[model samples]
Target: MTLRTIVVDDSIIFRKVMRDALSAIPGVEVVDIARDGSSAVDKIVAAKPDLVTLDIEMPGLNGLEVLEELDLRGIQTNVIVVSAHTSRGAEVTTQALSMGALDFILKPDNDNAGANLAQLKSELARLLKMVKAQPQLSMVSSSPAKSETLSAPIVARAPVRTTKTTSVPRPVECNLENLKTPKFPHLCHAIFIGISTGGPKALASVIPKLPATFTIPIVIVQHMPPLFTATMAKSLDNTSALNVVEATHGMPLAGGGVYIAPGGKQLGVKADARGNVIAVVTDDPPIKSCKPSVDYMMSSVPSSIARNSLAVIMTGMGDDGRDGVSYLRQNGCTVWAQSAESCTVYGMPRQIIENGLADFAFDLDDLPNLLSQLAYRAGGYCPVPPIPSTTAPMMATN
Candidate 1:
């Protein structure tokens, strides 16, 4: 089956290059090209293509404006955003995903045009195939308003006392006064989460669901570029009870907060002078073509909480979290995967689910309650302990 596609960019060269590149992917047909947003909208409507490669900085309407126009007009097409590797572009691209784009590709700097072009081809091919395989992806991307849920076995994974989760709640502004001490005296010490494509919106849905009383520190590895991760952290922080921030080296992990792995770097944790676990951000090499690989971060985590911590693999388009889930599971940690129906891209979670690595699989909406249950499992929170200075020797507390 040929996937009819359109390449929309202001640059004549990129449009031609993209057309040539996508044409090489098996079962893909470059149906047309649009050099601007207005033209893009018209070409998209006329061609009725299955996919669109849209540049974020196009003249006239720009990629984001095109998306909004498409949404207003109710035009349905799988949009793969093409963005420059910048903090601003990253911000807009994430907004596009939340607005309904399938995914995005970063434009490498001009110094390595040849290498960047080669990378783009492989990325496009992989994403196009994902769209083809998942019938529900069509509904989600084309009409951001509708949710075509698949009948997942939510009961299989829900904790014994969990009730049915009917809908995702709207986001609320954060309040830090409700913040507790870093040490989680409860049974669940920490939460490790990983996500990729369709992550911005998915995180918004899941994170805001955690109530203010929820006090476990959460570490997240969302596959994103450098500036993009920071933007995401701020976005999640604004709407969540958890005080979310981008991970920085030496920052101690504490309860009631969320840390986003900085883009382009590996994020992990280590024991500080006081034996308290602090953030470890590094320039480690990429794993499986991804910097800040889920496996890398997950491995850095100590196995002490394997019995009490919760590890989650959410929406994504690849097997990034597979080995990480394995590592956590081997240490006796309970692992959860977002159900296929609830995921924008099911690749990461599907990997663990198929391998018997995930201890449970639940819809994205169901996870918040499960995590809340995990947070308070020991029955109550540990009384607030004295705060220590940064340079003060840390003591082990969970």
Candidate 2:
């Protein structure tokens, strides 16, 4: 299927360059080009392109203004921002994400514009794949005889728990005997969780059940954009017993609180001169096509949490957490993954479970109870039963 696209930039040369690059992509066709944001908005409405590449610094109407116009008109076209690498540009790009831009690409320096143009082609191809994957493009009609409905709402649900607590709760007694514990003994000082796809819902189910007295600091990397992440964090904070907020650079990961990696920035934990672990947000290149990537967070755990870390990989697309899980396992940290049956997308967890990287695999429904048990254990939590020799096969669910 061919994806119709529009390129919007004030620079005549840059607009042509983007048009030529996009036109070269296999399944993408440049349907229109606009010299500025005003023209872009008009052409977008008339052409109704499947995707839009917007320049951040356009005159008359900036990229953000164009997005606001689209929002006002209820146009849900996929948009990618082309921005400079200046601090102001980075801030603008981040703000654009908060305003619902899909993603942003750094503009190449003037001296290396040619080389950068080559790189932009590959990036545009990646963006095209992401655009095709969006739910909005599913409405596009290929045949002239077929009618398309572009007015439907994109069904996006905030992550929330589906179950209610019963008056009579069954309690499972703790049995320390006959349990095979690790020889070196894993201690979790910080808990790192990587989730995507149905993460908000999964987090809502698990986080609210955690005790306010739970001491270990928690850090989460949920695949999402800025506004979505902000909304999710607020939702979690309101529902869960613990305090939750979008993570900021240099902030200390405090006990009994949850820190969510803000969207559009790579979040990593690093130790300071005083040996205190602090959150670091950077405009570093994306890992596995995500800024607030799971791999980035998981890779930083060994150094931050040292041998006393716990890592969990939940439902998500791709193998972002596989290597990070492996690293944690090798460093004597406990790593857990969601069972396939409980996942919206079984990609990340499947990789770890199949590769023997995960120490325990549990269904989503069982996670809250298991975590409660661990939290109640003496000298921190531990999984009751050891991992089976073979992994349980996982399946995708809505």
Candidate 3:
């Protein structure tokens, strides 16, 4: 299934560079190129290509306007935004994600053109592969679940009813009997989420939906570069009932406060002398090619809190959280994965699911309710219902 692609950029140089990069990626056919947003829109509507690599800044009609125009026309083709790492670029990119761009790539901000192009090709190749995996998805239509939440104010809802988990796929090495099915939600102390790729959009879907009465410290490692994560944190803060901020070094983790690992730095937690777990931002090298790697943050979980922690692996492009999840599971932490059907890129959650590390698999829309229930359970005022269990046995996939 070759992806019919178009490169839309005002700069002739970048247009050529993108075309060349796409041409190198297998199964990507650069069917056309547009020099500006107007021509891009015209070509897109006419050709109906499978994908478009769009530049955020353009003369006449910008990328955002093009997206708006596409939405007005009801075109749902794939769109991967190409942006610089500047403050303005980051701001618009975050907006683009919320406005339904599939994903984004940072343009070269350094003088190393060769290295930059190489990095661009690698990232583009990965995103393209993710796009190919779900042919039916588009930037405009990737998250149909968000419409309801977007239209209506997020209100507390009834607990999710029991659903048998027998349909979930199990990896061959995991033994269901050996798995610890303890009632860990009642003991949960903190929530750590690892997300990437479509994280901004996915987070927008889940975070804002969390109940206002909920009061658990939530930490997130959304794979993003510098400036972008900060912008994303601010964007999420505006809509979320909880206070959301970009984590800084030595900032104490506060209840009901949501902390996002800053882009370009590794974020982890360490307990101070008073036993207060605080966010630690480090200039550590990238792990699994992710500076703010989910594994890095999850590995830093204080042992005392490990058993009482709940780790969530959401949409992403790699297995950054797998090792960390394994560590948490060993420490008696509960792990939940976003259902593949609800994920924009199912890589991160798929890793945990395939490894048999996940205790529960839920759709994105189900997560807010599940978390609300867990928080309610921890409060001990009401008897929280148990998570749905597998009624019928599942065979491990070979």
TM-scores of the models, in the given order? 0.78, 0.55, 0.81
Q: Please give the lDDT score for candidate 1.
A: 0.73
The candidate scoring highest on lDDT is 3
Model 2 worst lDDT window (10 residues): 158-167
- Model 2 RMSD to the real structure? 13.7
Task: Please give the distance, in angstroms, between residue 164's alpha carbon in candidate 3 and its true position after superposition.
Answer: 35
Model 1 alpha-carbon drift over 4 Å, by segment: 111-116, 139-186, 272-275, 376-398
Which of 1 and 2 is ahead in lDDT?
1
Q: On residues 196-302, what C-alpha lDDT tens digit does candidate 2 reach at each position?
A: 75576678778988888776678999887665566667777888888999999889887777999988887877555454567877776666667687766766652
| Backbone clashes under 3 angstroms, per model | 3, 3, 0
For candidate 2, report its TM-score.
0.55
User: Candidate 3 residues 196-251, lDDT tens each?
Assistant: 87788888988999877878889999988899999999999999998999999989
The global Cα lDDT (0 to 1) of model 3 is 0.77
Name the better of 2 and 3 by lDDT. Answer: 3
Give the poorly placed runs of model 3, Cα more than 4 Å off.
109-119, 134-170, 173-184, 380-398
Higher-TM-score candidate among 2 and 3?
3
Query: What is the Cα-based lDDT of residue 85 in candidate 3?
Result: 80
lDDT of 1 by residue, 161-228 (tens): 11122231222342322221122223665778989988888888889889988877889999988888
Q: Between 1 and 3, whose lDDT is larger? A: 3
